[model samples]
Target: MKGGTKKIELYDTTLRDGTQGEHINLSVQDKLLIAGRLDEFGMDCIEGGWPSSNPKDEEFFKRAMDLELRHARLAAFGSTARYSDRIETDPNLLGLVGCGAPVITIFGKTWQAHSKTGLGISDEENRALIKNSVAFLRNAGREVFFDAEHFFDGWKDNREFALDMLKAAEEGGASRLVLCDTNGGSLPHEITAIIEDVRQHTDIAIGIHCHNDGDLAVANSIAAVMAGAIHVQGTVNGIGERCGNANIISIIANLVLKLPETGASVRDLTQLTSLSNFVFEILNLPPDSKAPYVGRSAFAHKGGIHVSAVMKESSLYEHIDPALVGNRQRVLVSELAGQSNIRYKAQELGISIPEGGEQIRKIVNHVKDLEHRGYQFDGAEASFELILQKELGTFTPYFEVIESKVYVESGIGGRNVDQAVLKVRVGEEIEHIAAEGDGPVNALDKALRKALIRFYPEIKGIKLVDYKVRVLEEKRGTSARVRVLIETGNGRTTWGTVGVSTNIIEASLRALEDSMNYHLFTLKATEPKPAAEENH
Candidate 1:
C-alpha cells in the first residue's frame, strides 16, 4: 500500500462485484477462501460485500472476523444513508459500523438523472446523503472510501454536480473518492480529461472502478491512474455484472510492467497465470485461451516459421518472457506444422528428437496424415504424445481390447439404457466385463475400467471429466467422420486425448483408450479418490 506514486492502493472487489457476474454464485465459505487468496496475493483492500442487503454477506463478515490477513484490509460495501436528516437511524449506516471490517465503501448517486429517478431526491439531498454517510462511518472509527457511482455518466451529464459530489466526500472525511463508470460506456480519452478536471478541484486521492461493456475497463482504469488517481479498484479475471468488471490480473500486470511506479503489491507478477487459473477453477469456468499475458495459449506458437523463429530466439515471437507471468511458450503440431514444430513439441514432452533425422520426418508426416483424416493434435496433446512415442518405438500397449459389444435396450415409454460388454487382455490374462450407463460412451468407459481395474488398480480414480464430439465433413451428414476429444482426470491432473473415425462409438472408444493409456503411462496414480478441483 505504500511503494508507488506516493502509494498506489489495489482494492479488490471480486467477492462483491465479481459475484454479480452471470452464473457466478459464491457462498460465504467461497468468499472467505477468495478473500484469503486475495490477501495472500497482496491486495490492499478486499471488499467483503454489502452487509445490509444480504444474509450471506452478513454471515461472511461475521466469519471473516477471524481471518488473519497480513496486509490487506477487509472492506464492507454499502450505499449511502437512507435519510439525510438523521444518519444514525439508517440501517445501511448501522450495518457498515456493525460489520466489523476496518474499511467501509459506500456508493452514492452522482448523476442527476439517477438522483431524480433512482433515489427520488434533489441534488442537495443527495449531496447531504453522501457527506453524512461518510461522516457517520468515519465517526464510527471506520476508514471510508466514497464510491461515486455513475460518476462518469454524471460528469458527462453535469460536470459541476459530479465534481461537487466528490468535494462533499472529501469534506466529510472519505479517504478515497472512487469514480465509477457504472455503465461502462466511457472512452479512455474522456476518462483522462474528466479526471484531470476533477484533480484541480479535489485534493483527496482518486480511484477508478470500471465495467467491461465496451471491453475497455482495463484501459479506462489505467488512464485514470495516469491522470493522478492513486487507488485502483477491480475484480480478478474481471468477473462482474453484465460484461464484468475490469480484470485486476491484467491491470496488475500492466501496472507492474509498464508503470512500475504504480503497483502497490510487493508480490511478484510472475504468479499472474496461476492466480488467473485459480479463479477460473473456483468458478468452474473454462479459461480464455486468448486472454492477455496469463492464459493457457498466451505464448503458444503453431506455425512452423514461428516455432523455428522462437527456437532460435523466443523474443522473436513473444512479447515478453512468459516466465514474468507464469506462462510458458508452447509449440503446437498439426497439419500446418513443420519439422521444427515436431522437434519442439517432442522436446517439450521430454522426448529427444534427432535433428533432421528420418524419424522426425516420419513423425511429422504421420501427424499431417492423421490431421488430414480429421484428427486435431493441438486440442489433444495427450493423443499427440502417444503418437510421438509410438513413432519413436517407445510406446507399448498396456492393455488391448480383444472383443467389444455395445447394446441399446428398448424401454418403451421410458428412458433407454446402454450396456457395454468387453473382453480385454492385459499381458497373459484376460478379463470379461459388462457395465451399464446412461449412454454408449459412458457404458464403454465403465466397462473398460471394470475389465482392467484389477490389473491397473491405480486407474480406479480416473474419470472422464469432459467429452466433446465434432462432426467433420458436414456435407456427409450423419455418416461423416466423428472426432471425439476426451478429458480425463484423477482428482489431481487432467489430460486430453482425441480420436477420429467414421463411427462415433469407435472414435469415442479410441479417445477413451488414449486417455486411460496416457494416465497409466505417465501417472501411476494409486487408489480411488474423491472428486477434487484440479487442473493441468
Candidate 2:
C-alpha cells in the first residue's frame, strides 16, 4: 500500500500487446510459459490475449483455462461491440463472453477523432457502444475493465466528450476505468492533472496504461498513481507497439524502493530480476544491459576510484542494495583498474594476495595492456576470472595447442567456401578435426569444439548461447582489431569469454579456446583435493 494505502494492482499484458513488438511472435506454448512465469511472480491480472483476433490467441486462451493459477486471474482483451449490433447478438461481444475468463477488458473510443474517423459514427452512438458493451459483460457476471483508448489526446482535444465516455463506462458497472496514453507522448505533469480531473468526476477506481514514446512511461505511471490511480498496466521489459509500453519491472522496483517514504510494501522485490530474465528467455530476446534496477549493468562499476570506494563501502557508489533485486554488484577490470581493484578481484576468486606483492601491479598492467588491444573484461566475467587465476599461478591449461589453420576455396560460380583445421594435444594424445561452414569463424568454432570433445566429453554439453563481435577501429572495418565475446551454456550454468585480434578467425579461435578452458578450469577448482593436501 502507498499514498492513500490502497492495494495496488498489477496488470501484465505481455502476451497480448507485448507481442506487437517487432519480430516478437509468441506461439500458444510461449504464451503459456510467459503466463506461468507471471503467475509465479505474483502478478495480479494476466491479459492472456484477444481471443477474437487470431486462432493462436484463441487457442492460448482455451489452453490457459485449464491451468490452475494461484495468484493471477486470467483476462481476455478485445474491443467493444459495434455501434449497430446488440451485445448478445454481436459475434465480437459474444466471443468476449464465451472466452470463459473471469475478467474481460474492452476498449472504447474516448477521442472524438476516432469516433468520427475510425468508427465513422457520431459521438452519441460511440457512447452508446461503450455503455452497452460494458453493461453486457457485467450482466454476464464477468468483471469488466474499460480502457479509454487515447484518453489523454482525446481529453486535450475535447474534454467534455472524453469525460462523457468515462462516465458511460462508470454507469455501465465497469470495475475499473483505465486512461491510456496510447500515443505515449504525454508529460508527467499533464498526466497528473488529467488523472486528478478524472478522479474528481468518477466514483470508480482509476488505472493508468502508458506507452514509452517519450521515454516517460514510467514517470507518467508514477504521476498517475500519485494523482490517485490504484491500478497500473504495463508489459514486462516494455515490449509493445512502436516505442513500447511502460516497463513494469522498473516501475515496481522504483516504487517499492525509491518511494518507500510513501509507505509502499512490496513483499518480494528480489523476484524482479528473475521475472525480467524469465520473460527475456521465453521471448528469445537479449535483455537490455542498461535497463534500470534489473539489468546486468545496473550495479556494475568500473574505474579505480569507484572500485576502491565500493570495496570500502558499497553504499558509496551503489544507490540500493543489488541483492534487493536478486542481482549482485560487479567490479569491472579494465584499463581503469588499479592495484586495489586487482587485489579485490583476486580475493573474490579465493586467491590471497601475498604481503609486499608486486603481482597486483603486474596484473593491473597486464589487464590495461589487454584492454588497450580491445579485450573487454567487463561483460565477460569468466574470461576475467581466468585472467585472475593465471595471475595467481592457480590456472592450469587443459590442453596444449599444436596448430590451427583456415583454408578457403573459390568455386567456378565465384562462390567462396571456408574450412578450419584444428589440432590440439591433451596430455599425450593429439586430436585433429576439420569442419566446413559458411564462414571462417563458424568453421573454426565447429572444428575446435569437435577436437576438444575427443579429450573431454564435457565439452559436448557446452553449447554457444550468444556471439557478439565488435570492431575496435571502426575506420578499419574488416582489418580492424576485432573483439569477440562468446556465451556458452552447459544446461546448468552459463559463462562468457572474450578474445581480440586483427584477424577475425584468430579472434574467434581464441574465444573458443578460452570458453573450453574456462569449463575445464571450473571443473578442476570444484574437484576434491588430493589425499596428501587434505591431510596437511
Candidate 3:
C-alpha cells in the first residue's frame, strides 16, 4: 500500500546462494529450519536449493515437503540444459522437474565471454539453452523463472544479445525474467538506466540478484526497484559466495521504512532481528554487532553527550525505534558513561536506586578506574550488571569459593586427562567436587558445575559456547595479565561475560563465575525463587 503500482516481491535464496559463502555449510535439517523461518517472515518466494547439485539439497527437498508453509512458494534452482543435449533429455533439467517444487528457477550464461569460454558454446546456442529450459519447465506446469546470469556485464559488452536473451525467456513462457548482477560491480546509476532500458524493451516482470563484491548490491537492488523491477532476490545477512549477496534484511528495512512509494508489503517487521539471528545461530556464526538494522550496536549509545540526548529524546540520536525490528536500544556503560547512562542501565536491569547524586557518580568513577586497568564493559554487559548491582548494595553472592586445584596426567594407554578439584560454600553447606575434562579450563568448569548443580539444578541447562583469552602485557611474559571473555548459552539464549587478572586460570574463573551468575539471575527473573534460597 505504500509504494506505487509496482507490487514489490521478495525472494530469499539463503538456502541456495547463501551456502556458497566460505565456511558456510548447512545440513538438510538446517536448511529446512531456515525455510520455515523465511516463510513465516513472509517472503514471496523461497529458493530451497539446487536439487541436481548435491545429495544434501536433494534430501532437503524431500524433507521440506512435510513443512506446513503458509505464504511462500518453494523453488528448485538449476542451470539450463547442457549445450550437448536436448532440454527434455538433460539430466539436470529432469532433476528440477523431479524435485516436486511448485516453482523452478533456471539460469543460463548471458555474457558472451562466459558463453564462449566458460561453457564453450556459441552465442546462438546459449540463447537456445535459456529458451528451451524455460519452455520445458513451463510446459510441465511449474512456475518458471529465467535468471540471465551476468546480465549487466553482458549488456555492457553487447547490449543486443542481452536484450535478445530477455525476449527469448519471455517467448519461452518464463513467468519472470531475473537480471543477475552476479559480479556485483555495477553502480546504482548503471542499474537504474539498464532496468529502465529493459522495461522499455519488454513488458514482462523483471527481478534482480546482486552480489556484494563492490559493496553496492543493496544500492543497486533498490535502484532497480525504483526503476520498476518487481522482484528482489537476495540472501539473509548477505551471506553468499565471494563478498556475499545483497542483504535482504537491509533491503527490506530501506524499502519499508525509508522509501515512500516502493509499494512493498512486509509482514511482521518486528521479527526481522529474530529472523536474522536465527539464521546466524543455525550457522553457528556470531551475529554482526554493527549490521544495519538488527545488530547489537545498531542503536547502542556509549558517548556521554549522546546518551544524555537519547534519554531526553530517543529521536535525537536514533533513526528509528529499535523495537520496530525486535532490537532494543542500549546505553553502554564505560569511561564515557554519564549519570544518564548509569540511570538507564540500572532501570533496564531492574535495580532500585536511591535518589542520590553521589551514588551514581561513585559508580561512574569506579567504571573509569576499572577501564584504566584494561577492563572493557562495553561488550560484556553481564559483568557490568554484577558490578552495578554490587555498587548499589543489592548484590548477593551465589556461591563463595573456598579453594580450587587442577591435576594432569598421561595414562599408560596413550590417553591424557586433566582433573580439577573445587570446594565452595553455598549458604551454610560446603560442597567438594572433582571432575575430569579434556583440558584445565574444561575440567575446572566441570568441577565447579558439579559442586553447584545439586543446589542450583538450573545450572545444568547452561553450557559454555565460546572462550577467548587475550594477554594484556607481554613484558611480564608468563605472568602477563590476561583477559578472558566467555560466551554461555542455555540452548535458547546467549550472553557474554568477561574477567581479567594476572593468572590465566584466575581470569577464566572470574568470567566463568560471571556467566553462571548471569544465568541464575535470568532464571530467577522468569521462574519462582528456589526453595533452597529461602533457607539463607
Candidate 4:
C-alpha cells in the first residue's frame, strides 16, 4: 500500500459504551443482529458489551460464540481489576476470560484525579493495575487493548505520569494503547500535542475514543488520526452516554470522501445510509434527518438560491455527490422556492413539466400562498408531492370524507375518553365507523383507519410514528392557528405530512388524510399492471 493508502482500523463500541445511553437498551438478540450488520459493512472490530457488568452482556458473549462473523473480530470489553484484588481473582477479569472472544479491551485510570480522588487509590497502584491486567490477558493468549482512560486530561495535569501509564501498558504485552477523552473536554490542539508527545515516547499502535460533550468528538478523533492514531473507536450514529460518542459514519465520510489521498475506506461508502438506518431501526429510534453523510436532509436543498444553483451545477451547493454515500439530493418546495425549485421538485416526483410552462409558475405561487396561510412543505415532502400531483392533473381522489365528529367526555370515573365517528366514500361505497381512544387525535386516527383498512388493506401497515403541533400565530392566543406534522412509517419507509388550521382537530385530520393518501398513491403506483397491459 502507498503512503496515501494508510489503512486505519475501524472499531465499533455501540454494544458497549453506546448502551450507556439513557434510552438505549438492546436485548441480546439486538446485539447479535447489530454485530452481523456491522460485519457486513466491513467494520474491523465490533466490541460486544462488557461481560462483567450485566447478565445480558454476558449472555450476548455466550450467544456470539456461534455467530459466523466474516469481516469483524468480536472484542469483549471490561475494566482492569480493582486495587483490592489480583487479576486472577477479579470477577471482571474472570468474565472477560470466560467470554472467549479473540480480542479483549480493558480500561484503567490514568488521570491522577481519578486515581487519587475518584478511585481512592495510590498512583502506583493504578499503574500496577494497568500493567497486571494487560499482562494477565496477554498471557491468556488474548490480544489485549489497554484503554488509557482520561489520557488527554491526565497529560494536561502531569505529562510525566501519563506517559508512564502508556509505558506500563506497552511493557505488559499489550497490542495497542487506546487513549480515551473520557470527560470529552479536550480541544483539537490539546489532543494533537499530547498524541505527538506519546508518539515520541512509544512506537505502539495508538487508538482514540471520544465523547461528544463539547460537540467536538468528531473533530478531536480526526485530529488524533492525523497525529498518528491507527484505530478509531466510536458508535454507529454517535449514540452513547450523556451527549453521545463520536459518530464513526461522519469520520468515515471524512476519511473516504474528503481525504481521498488517505485511502482509508472502512466499507462500501454506498452502504452507509442503509447501515445507519438499520442500526436506528434496531434501536427503535428515529434517524436524525440532518445527520451528515447519511441523513435525509444531508443532501436536501431547500433555499431557492440553493435549489437553482444545484439544478445548474450541484457542486455550487453540494460538497459531494449524495449517491456516493447511498443518499440523493432533494429539491424542496416552499414559500422561498422559485420556479426552478418547483420544476426540480416536480421532476423528482416523476412529473414532467414543459420548459417555460405555466404549471411550474403556478406551483410557485400556490406554495407561497399556502405558506402565508401557515402551511410548511419543507419538512413534509409527502404533502408537497400530493399538492403537486393535484395541481398537475395527475392526482385521483382516493376517498372523500362526508362528515366527521369527535366527542370528549369525563365521567364519574375521572378518566377522559374520546370518541370519533367518521363517514367517507370510496367510489360508490360509503363506510361509517366510530372508535374510542385516549384522545381526540387518537380517536380520529382509529376511526379513519377502521373506515379505510378494508377498502385499502395496505393502510393497515401504515403506523403513525410521531406527531408534533406548532402554533403558527401566538397573537390569536387560544384561537391561534396551528401546524401539525405527522410522521408515518410502513415498516421500511417513513414519510412526513403537514397540515394547518385554526382547530387542532381539523389540522390533525388534514395531516392524517394526506398521510393515508400518500401511502395509498404509492401502493397504487407500484402495483403490478393488469393482464391486458402486460400482454400489450
Per-residue lDDT of 446-520 in model 3, one digit per residue for the tens?
A: 999999999999999899998998888988899889888888999998888888999778788888889888888
Off by over 4 Å in 2: 1-3, 260-267, 396-403, 410-439, 442-466, 489-491
User: What TM-score would every model get versus the actual structure?
Assistant: 0.91, 0.91, 0.87, 0.89
Taking the tens digit of each residue's C-alpha lDDT, what string does model 4 give over 88-206?
Answer: 89999988988989999998888888888998988788888889988988998999998999999999999888889889899988888999999999999988988888988998999
How far does residue 37 in candidate 1 sit from its true spot (Å)?
0.8
Query: Can you write out model 2's per-residue Cα lDDT over 1-536, one digit (the tens) per residue?
Result: 23455667889999999999897889899899999888878888999999888889889888998888988999999999985467778788788888899999999999999999998999889999999899999999999999999999999999999999999999889999999999999999999999988988998999999999999999999898888888899999999999999999987887678765444444477988988998898888888889988889898888889988999999999999999998888777889888767777777767787856677778888999999889998768788888878888888778866789999999669988888998888888898889887788778878887877867887877888989999899998777899999998999999889989998777888888889999988987789999999999
lDDT (10s digit) by residue, model 1, range 41-112: 788899999999999999999999999999899999999988899799999899889989999999998898
lDDT of 3 at 380: 78
The collision pairs in model 4 are: none
- Candidate 4 lowest-lDDT run of ten: 1-10
Residue pairs with clashing backbones, model 1: none
In every candidate, how many clashes are there?
0, 0, 3, 0
What is each predicted model's overall lDDT from 0 to 1? 0.89, 0.88, 0.89, 0.90
User: Model 4 lDDT vs. the true structure?
Assistant: 0.90
After superposition on all C-alphas, the RMSD of every candidate to the true structure, in Å, is 5.4, 2.9, 3.9, 3.4
Ranking of predictions according to lDDT: 4, 1, 3, 2
